[model samples]
Target: MKKIHLVWSFFCVMYVSLAIAAHAEEKIIQGKEEIEKSICELNIKGQIEKEFHLYVTDGYQEMADGEMIYFWGFTHAKDFADVEEIKTKAERNAKLLPLKVPGDEIRLTSGRNYVVVLHNAGWYETEEHSGINHVAHTIHFHGLDLIPALDGVPNLPYPSVFPGEIYRYLLTIPEDIEGTYMGHCHVDSTNHIMSGMYFPIIIEKKPNEIYGYTFDREYTLFMSELDSEYMETLREVGDIRRGLDWNSNYFMLNGRIFMDNLTHPLSTINDPKTRIVAYDGETVLVRLLALGYEHIFAWHPHGFHGLVIGTDGRKFPFAYEKDTLLIGSGERYDILYKIPDFSSKRKCLSCNYGPGISIAHDHNMKGMVSGGIYPHGPMTIFDIRPKKMTP
Candidate 1:
């Protein structure tokens, strides 16, 4: 009886030791998975830390009609090796350095944190708007459910970012909300938004998690209009409220007229870049957004139709194919464009041949013109090239 008791005690102790060791191993594996997931969430270059400094300044953009339009815009604050380098560079070309094109697009992944440092660089006078200079600006992210303090609304949540003042915005892209959203200035929206303080915000889902579909390439189109009259009125009156009667003279795709859209590469011309390049037999995803306050754009692709898979960041129950889509103001559409084989002899609805450059333009003929110039507004090309061989 004494021998049996000794063996039972020894077996019980060994079982408890083994159980504790297994639990510890499980915890270590869990910790490793958590670390790997965090690394995977980093930016494309694997840099875990990223910061974007957006400097708001006033400038001029030459329109396709040879008219220089006065504009209030944002430029990325270029990084310098040190403070002395920045000061030295500023002294030489202070005028030319801040006067860049539209702001860069803010790309985020779901379940990640981002810090957007907004700096209101001092105002500048333009020849077109000689009397008026740029003023306080705020970033209002459309369709984001943010706290009131970070909403970027003047007088309601937080005051406008004053000139020479810096404001840091802490934002988290929620896992549930993933898609294309718009960001613009909420201060005097009518004037500021039309003045080009806007860009697209794309929140992507997890790597293995598919959102109803998949694609090989992605492109974004921010359909907007330029109300030159309204801008001029604001310049003269210094109040956006007084410029209520608005008339848009220039239609744009990603802040460029039709000609720039055809010439410039993807993401080089403007914020919410518009150009698209894909290989034959590849699936391309197009994120379409209309920023106009009143205009509804009828988006049409010439060569092939697109499969309408999602709208306003939500997947559709049934996907439908259409050649033209009527997108209303503040609306978003996710279109999947599947390229056919290059050798296939497919004919488009308008009797165009396939596997070539397709003219994607607004079906609203009026939106295809810039100051009465036909075929010179909001048109871009979808170039489908033959697949290249791997080295």
Candidate 2:
């Protein structure tokens, strides 16, 4: 009877040990599962939000002919400590926040939320405007698939943003969309766009995703034209509704003529924007955007052919190589330009063959001139240096 009791006790102890071991294993698995769930929640909450403040106001843009043209456009609004401090800050940073033509570049990453608050400041008479220049404006992303309410078309889904009014544009760049896009005024698009109310928006691919090809440098080339007659009408009439011929007197890249672009690679004298800087044996990605209302630009590189890799926010199935590409109004092209090694025959006049300069300009002969001035229109220089030289 004692031996039987001992065996039963031993079995009870074994059962208790096994039960405790099983419970401990279950608890460990549950803890691991909880940790994994928490990690996922953290990843979901990690999406970033980008915000910007843009003010739409009437301003003056200097033309290549040394004339200040009256125009309606956007500018970056600087942050102040309070509403009362804005005037003092503006006075302090007057040179820092001068009126910018071509607006500001809207750069956003894929898979993020962008909130741009547009404030319509009442038009102030400048030397160019004198007594004219009054118009409502709204921002319209040319190729983005956004909700109708957020679209900046006036009187279609919402009214145009008037003076002293504000509108917030909420946008979410999809993870799949990555390339160059354009934004401009949808209200009185023909006149407003011609009167300098457009900008470029670039969406970059995420880090983890492979964009197929990597580039050493990138440049944004915004090709646009100006009609002086239409601008004059806007200054005289103060009404954008006045119909005028869409004749382009000035062709520009980033608001500067060819000579000015060569001197100031990026933005015009009024604002600094984009410039092309590269070295030999290096690759560059050029974001080509044509913002003209009617003209089509045939962009040609002098020394080398560019590999057309993408268009309108999507990569091509295969790269297409061409020396000249025709880009119409509201079109974007992603061209990969590979800088060639310098040859004695192709050396530039300025660099003694050490750093070669090649001209990239519009293929259309008319586009090469601004206001009847030769070599003063839509053109820029590609400064290619030896691999050892700094760019």
Candidate 3:
């Protein structure tokens, strides 16, 4: 009877502890709130078709290991809904965002004139950039057809924008060119880009429809890596004076990594910007952007194959199918993935497994490893569901 009582008490204690821990975890929400809209509003307070007020600065992204990695980024400063809201220069400083790594994804319509007011507010030392540096920064529109003047390269004629300086980049997107693109810091391209000063630049024929193709859903798998040791050196010295040794360890998909990335709100399971969700027979367009300094990102899906329709923002005349895709730095690939519908039983021999997940991850060992852990980096998922199962 005494032994029975002790066992009962032990079970009760275990149950109570688990309950307490559950309650504690319930209060902690993973991932940040969707600060920027999935696709930002266009024609925001400008006479042109689209105009962006961007603020440049620094911020910190807390990695899966709880390490706060410092990054340089751009954030939407002003989306002046009303003309009355447009005030002095100080007003633009109100919505400065420096905490995000990839910056805001700029979506533009084809055959529309757009302008970007690039304001260099310097490092992320403080929310308000009181102390500025001489280091210049510029936006190099990778894979986008642009003139040398707007190229964002540091040269004698068109110098990169420095601290406390603002430069306006104007471009008219041609109807012929509309697809995946990228924008990054061109000044000290090696150091600046690797340090996390980049974002996806996608020009669409419309919203979800990319000219010849239409997608039920879309996701941007922006692939990049972090070298903690190299970053640490830059963090301490304020710059990479010794040149890039090129030792990246942590690989990420849309700024999140590993098992934590799979469950975290900032992941494919949650982040609106990179969630791979599709119903039976639905098509999901995945824009693969490799922005890292080194390596070829070899990615593949577990259950199904993807149709490679475009590369580097240009649609190919013929769409080819591939189970695995290899993309290099500064490169982009647009692949269309069609979910096998459960209703179409003849087509889905694999659907016998039923509605489940298909892990889309980098096959490259470097992409899958970090700090001696297998399957620890650059992973996302494709949540496929039956017609009845989907909400």
**Could you give the C-alpha RMSD of every candidate to the true structure, in order shown?**
16.8, 19.0, 22.3
C-alpha lDDT of residue 300 in model 2: 88
Flag regions of model 1 displaced more than 4 Å: 1-49, 79-102, 126-134, 206-212, 236-239, 260-273, 343-355, 389-391
Expressed as tens digits, the lDDT of each residue in 207-287 for candidate 1 is: 322365788878888788878777765656566565467778888887777654333432223323465777778888898
- Estimate the TM-score for candidate 1: 0.75
Q: Write the per-residue lDDT of candidate 2 for residues 1-391, one digit (tens) a residue.
A: 9999999999999999999978866764565355445444544776336557776666677665676777767776454111111223243235224565676678888887766666666566434444443467789988898866567887555567776676667677888888889888888788878878888988887532225778888888888888877776666666555645678888888877755433443323223344466777778889899978677899987767899988988789999999999999999999988776662126555423233666678898788888788777777767666677763
Error of 1 at 372 (Å): 1.4
Task: Give one digit per residue, the lDDT tens place, for model 3 in 1-391.
Answer: 9999999999999999999876644432110011111113334534368668676666677766566776767766446122222133444345554357787788888888777767776664432322223467888888876766667777522567777776667777887888889999888788888888888988988777875888988888899887867765665565556445868878888887756434565444466666576788898899999977677789887777899999988878999999989988988999998877763233323323334665678888778886557676777666676777667
Backbone clash pairs for candidate 3 read: none
Give the whole-model CA lDDT for all candidates, comma-separated: 0.69, 0.71, 0.71
Report the alpha-carbon TM-score of model 2 versus the true structure.
0.77
Model 2: colliding residue pairs: 266-274, 267-273
How far is 187's C-alpha from truth in model 1 (Å)? 0.6
Residue 123 of model 3, lDDT score: 62
Backbone clashes in candidate 2 total 2
